[model samples]
Target: MRQPGGDEDGTEPGDGEPGSRLAALGGLHLEEAPPDGGVPATGRSPRTARNRTLIVSALLAATLIACLGTAVHLFLRINEPSSAERPPPPPPPRPGASMSGPAGGGPRPVAQPVRTENDLDMVCADRFYPSAPRFRGSAPHPVMISEGEETGADFRSTRTLNRAAFAGSATQRRTWAPDPERAQIVACLDLTGPGRKIRDCRAGDGTLPLVEGRYRLAVYEVATRRRILQKDLTGTDRACPFVIRTGAGDTLHSAVKDQQLYDLLHQRVEG
Candidate 1:
């Protein structure tokens, strides 16, 4: 039999039924609900949402990579040395010393000092004329000779002597002449000897004289009072008769027929 306001199943229309209870519990609606009554749609599809998420993730990854790269660049720049901050290069190695190794290794040969002609000239000028002195009159001092004529040739001879003095064969101390500008009294030959009358000896002022028969030749060191050579020549048997007596009293006679000394004297006389 049918009941009032009940269905055939014997449950009332609005009563707690299985379908209604399920609908209430599940919060589902069979018909479309009002806009303000149910959960609202996000107005975006699932695929669209996923795509937006992937785009954001990609942007974040790129930004992170850029920051890491920038940090690495900064680190490298800070560690690098600038030109001014860098240490200076080492100096060049000295002569005769090996760049590598020590003792027992053969020492490298050292280069000898080289002297030029101009250097020799300057040395001669200094040795010949050291200082200026007042003479009796404007008549250029009798002892002072023209540097251009007298000293030039003598300079050449002195240059030769300098080389000999420094050579390994030299037995005397290596010495050079005084500055010519400081020299007051030039070297002069004392003609009060018998050899001067025999040879008709005539030497330019400030020149070394060439004499014959028992003559003495002496070379006084320029800077000091030391005498290097003092020779006494006697007899006429030798062609260019001359003798060189060292300070040690060792006597060296010139070659019997050698004209080297004569040639040197001729050059001085001509100049």
Candidate 2:
């Protein structure tokens, strides 16, 4: 059992002992010496600690710089508008030519009697009652009606009183003259119906003669001849044609140039 040399703890040392012998062979004293080329057993090497501290300090500096920049930007934004403030704009101008009366040297003009053509134009549309009798003229048969679309922009219905003429019961083709020229005789409408809305007229001239009498004319549709929308040419003519937009209660008075379309409307009304 006991062969070679007895070890320190009463066990034989093998050809290669585990710890102290190996250290000694490699030039290290177990209790005192360090391995070959190894650092001393003091604290830590100055260079390693310095490098780690430098890296941590660099990261911390970067974080502090980013925070400071963000704070500065927020502060500038908050102060810029208040420091460079601009005043509110002035109120808009008043509408009419003169705020005072024409006599006060504001907008001077002599008052004159309204002429015949002016009176005739005045007969076109009356704003007070949009679908009432707007034109009160010397014409024999006065026709009033309302027609036009109901706003927005879809297929909607419109209505108008084209013309109304009283020609003494005799059926005859008549020649009517408007201010500009001799326009063809279109359909005449009779506003004998229960409901009638008269609108204002936009007449350029206040002194135009409209023949005073009942008339018979043909109402022709410029668009389609479908019986459902065809007009009759045997009624009174408004001083002008008025267009009504659906939904919105706004009314539009047509110009004399638009009488042809009015003629069509007259047919629709009467028919």
Candidate 3:
């Protein structure tokens, strides 16, 4: 419904307001001229308004993109561990001692005994040679025991090797462990050093330091629990073949070298 007073806002005819009068007469309003009579200053063009909206939208989009990029960079920097965040590398593998696991088992770490001296002075680079005569008859299976309360390695790996060796060998392979009191022969421990830590273990000029333990071991006939033979007994009986030296100050003072002890019995005693 067209109002009689004006187009909509109630402006009458012949009013000085050109805009309202023109709007009442026609839909288009008159453009007001500039002060210098140059181009007219009119209402904002739709195209120019649309261009400004597009530019503002583009700027906001770019800002949003930059913000996202910065956020992603910060996330990576936070998640990625720095040198301080990373754990220290494991200590490098030790040197010298190179023994591996025992036979028939997976890799058994050669557990080093407590920190003893990593080195020893071979006062005499003495080879194993006992001066006693080779006795007749079969050698008994040695029931391995030790000098103190069995703790630490107790030379356990050596014992593991010995047990495994006996289990594998023919000459001294007795399934039953022999009683020291009742058995015909017993290899008893006579002395042991501070493992591989003793400064000088040599008792005499030619005798070996009681390194691991068996260097001073004695073979005794149980009836008379006296020493029938020491490391000095004749015919190639060894003092102790010093075992291996492992990583970082790891060493074996008197680890028996191999299964040669039973092999010696295999060589000597008559049936």
The clash numbers for all candidates, in the given order, read 12, 48, 7
Quick one: best TM-score, which candidate? Answer: 3
Local distance difference test, per candidate? 0.34, 0.33, 0.37
For residues 1-271, write the lDDT of model 1, one tens digit per residue: 6787676778765577687766554523444444676533434456788999999999999999999999999999999899899999997855422211223542222232213223223322332111233222322211111121121122222222333234433232121132333222222211112233222222224223244334333332223212333344443433332433223111222221113323322222222
> Which segments of model 1 are wrong by more than 4 Å?
1-43, 87-271
TM-scores of the candidates are 0.21, 0.24, 0.27
**In model 3, what are the clashing residue pairs, if there are any?**
97-245, 97-246, 130-234, 131-234, 132-233, 132-234, 212-254
* Model 3 lDDT per residue over 48-153, tens place: 8899999999999999999999999999999999998899999775432121111243222222221211110000111111221123355543332222112222
Q: Which candidate is the best by lDDT?
A: 3
For model 2, how does the per-residue alpha-carbon lDDT over 1-271 read when each residue is reduced to its tens digit?
5545764556644445577457544433333436584565654566889999999999999999999999999998887766348566676754321211122322222133222222222211110112222222333212222221211112212123223323322221121222211111112222212213445444344322232222222232111111123332322454544432233223332222235444544433323
Poorest 10 consecutive residues of model 1 by lDDT? 143-152
RMSD of 3: 17.2
Judged by TM-score relative to the true structure, which candidate is superior, 1 or 3?
3
Candidate 2, lDDT over the whole model: 0.33
lDDT value for candidate 1?
0.34
